[model samples]
Target: MTTSKKRKREIDDTQRVSFALSDQPVTQLGPVLAHFPSIKPTKSTSFKCYKTQTQKPMIDNEDMPFAEIPMLVAGETEAVDFYSSEETRRGSLGSRYFVGVHNKRTGITTLRAAPLHILTHEVKALKGLQPAAVSTLQRLEARAALGETFGTKKAKLAIRAQERNKVDISAMEGVADHLQESILKNTSTLPSKEEAKASADSTRLIPQYDIDALNSSDIYPLHNMIPKPEWKALSISAYMSAGGGAERVALLPFKRSNWINDHLAIAFASPSPNKTAIKMLIYISTMIAFHKATFKDINKEVIQQKLPMVPSVVIDGLLSRFTETARGSIEARRTPEKGTMLLTHMFALCLHVDDFATDTSVLAADLSMEPAKVNMLFKTLGCKVNKLTQSDLKRLGLPDSAGEVKRAILKTPLEFPKPRTRRRA
Candidate 1:
């Protein structure tokens, strides 16, 4: 087993250094370097930015491209090393970027540090660092990992055994009959009746919902149609709305609503007092106020931060629900067909999977759905969850490396359920 370190000072890897640089050297400017044309250019007093410009070819109308900075003598690595070796304020732009001075005649390039924006961007730490997991496990882990237990070897062993299998054990059932006598001998060390009574009485069972106990958020009603940008980016399903007017709007896929409401806050801001949108706003707002208090895991704190026109996802659900529940009529009508149960169910999958609704079942049993059923659903809905082939992806013109979320909504084997129509009001 040999390492590169064994072949130390490997000179062959170093690029051949040009022998043209005199005692007075050239400086490199932004990607290009200032260079002499044919013979070295006459000295000028003007503010010469060290970067180079192309010179016309000696022959035809064609102009030759300027020489690029050499990788070994003067590119990203050399720039980085030079900055690292310098004794100055750490991580300055001068440490990173350089103006290049190229000498076409001598075939040499010199790099000089230049002031530039060593741009800093607030790149959120990517989520993949942890891998995709549902919220249920995240919460369960949070509790179990942080939970406190009595410091006892017996307790630790019991937990380990429970993890292996949920079972009850009796010492004498498997072990020696002498274990019973050992236990009897230790009975005298047990706590008194008062201690036992005190422990039993410590737990109180009472329910209280104070005025202050309200959860969820306060927000205006959301539009019945999948309102644009309210929930931020709508999923690929948004285009599913193919009918003419608002009826087409109702068919926008399940992911849009689920992502906003289940993933975020849902508020219902009212429209004008007499308007249906207003009524929707009121109903959703009230529902949000109720659900936030009851639902186990929403970030209610995030729900309250107000946006311009739309309520957060928290409130959006309520508004949509209220309109559906109220029956297409605020004044007098039937369901306007803003959305469908199938659409809702698809998004529900996202919310449930994210909340880890399926995790327990997956852990206990099998997660893979019946392939027959999946194929049937695809046949019924005329869609694909994973058309897992390079050619199919090329046909769609979608990138081969689309995200899980994209795959979830686009590639999902969802059937467009037959639309139900109401008797004309």
Candidate 2:
């Protein structure tokens, strides 16, 4: 036979392996075939058949080992790529959902897996529609790409309203200045009765009374109406016939008396007097006395040293409690050092008591009386007597000395004193 025809016969008669071979494995099979020339594998081929006959391919699946493969039921089996099916590929990375995304600007495609709760282009992630979410990723990206701020509708409206309602502070100041100038220009003109009444009502002092202690008699009286009894309400003839004019008549039944006496009776049932208030009054009076006596500025520390018995805290608290009135009074009493007046004994004599004797002899006798003489007289009689000087009497708000206590008396009503008369020879 010819050589060509003999080679053709050898190729056609070589033994074939009934197995599928892919492009990758076919190269690996070259050495095996070199060792065993009888193995001639064929390239893998997919058969196209009717859907009814499609079950044969799935029934004969060789890709999965028995341990990895699931149990097959007697029905048209799904052609599942056991390693790379949608379910297997999705579950391979655990439960996270993955989405295919492409960025238009960068022209890059990527598979992004997001958490279960976050919304993405993934159909599995879009479980609910969130209407109240103020911003979306697309809106944010659009703003960023444009390189400008784009506020939400609500924020835009609020900004517009604020701008519209913003007040001009300069204009308000100008208006206030104009109004003040107008008021000053019209100062000579009298206000109308209504305006005056309104001003008075608006500016009326509001008393700061403690509401919890509103029932105190000092704050609110029991009744505002004046009471007149039948006895006092009667005619003069009837009063005279009933012996009302001769002796005291009871205004009301059951030991009727003046309200002052009644109030005093009620006070008798109360606790002891406020010694703190008395001490504060005495300390303040003593400070004033020292200022008059020394003819010096009223220094609190010096006054405190002089009156060591007085409590500093009590006086400070009292001054604070009556700050408005007490401050002005204290400031007035504290005269400047430059024009300070030195009070003389004659001035002190006039200041000692509210009553003044016009007679010089009587005044001289009263002022010159010695307390030791009175005490000696009382000592011989074995009588205890607290002999007090005019200054001590003045401290208790009592009538003291022969003349008048000038500080105790209100100076407004009293006329300037006439020059002291010369004694007749």
lDDT of 1: 0.33
Clashing pairs in 2: 350-404, 351-405, 351-406, 352-405, 353-404, 353-405
Off by over 4 Å in 2: 1-295, 314-425
Q: Which window of 10 residues has the lowest lDDT sum in candidate 1?
A: 204-213
- The digit string of per-residue lDDT tens for model 2 on 1-425 reads 65554544454322432222222321121110011123222334121111123333564424432222322111111231111123332333444343445545444455433222211122224336645422333454464444435776676676567657756565465666677668767985879977875565343222121223322222211111111231123222221234331231221111222321232233233466333222222332333334343344444576556545435653343223222233536542333321111112122222222122112222223334354542332222112234345764564445555324222221222222223579999
Instruction: Give the least accurate 10-residue stretch of model 2, judged by summed lDDT.
Output: 27-36
Model 1 ranges off by over 4 Å: 1-225, 229-314, 322-381, 385-387, 393-425
In model 1, state the lDDT of residue 40.
29
Residue 33 of model 2 has an lDDT of 7
TM-scores for all candidates?
A: 0.17, 0.17
**Cand. 2 TM to true fold:** 0.17
- Scored by lDDT, model 2 comes in at 0.32
Q: Give the clash count for each candidate.
A: 34, 6
Give a tens-digit lDDT track for model 1, residues 79-134.
12111112212334234545556666555676554443121112134423754433
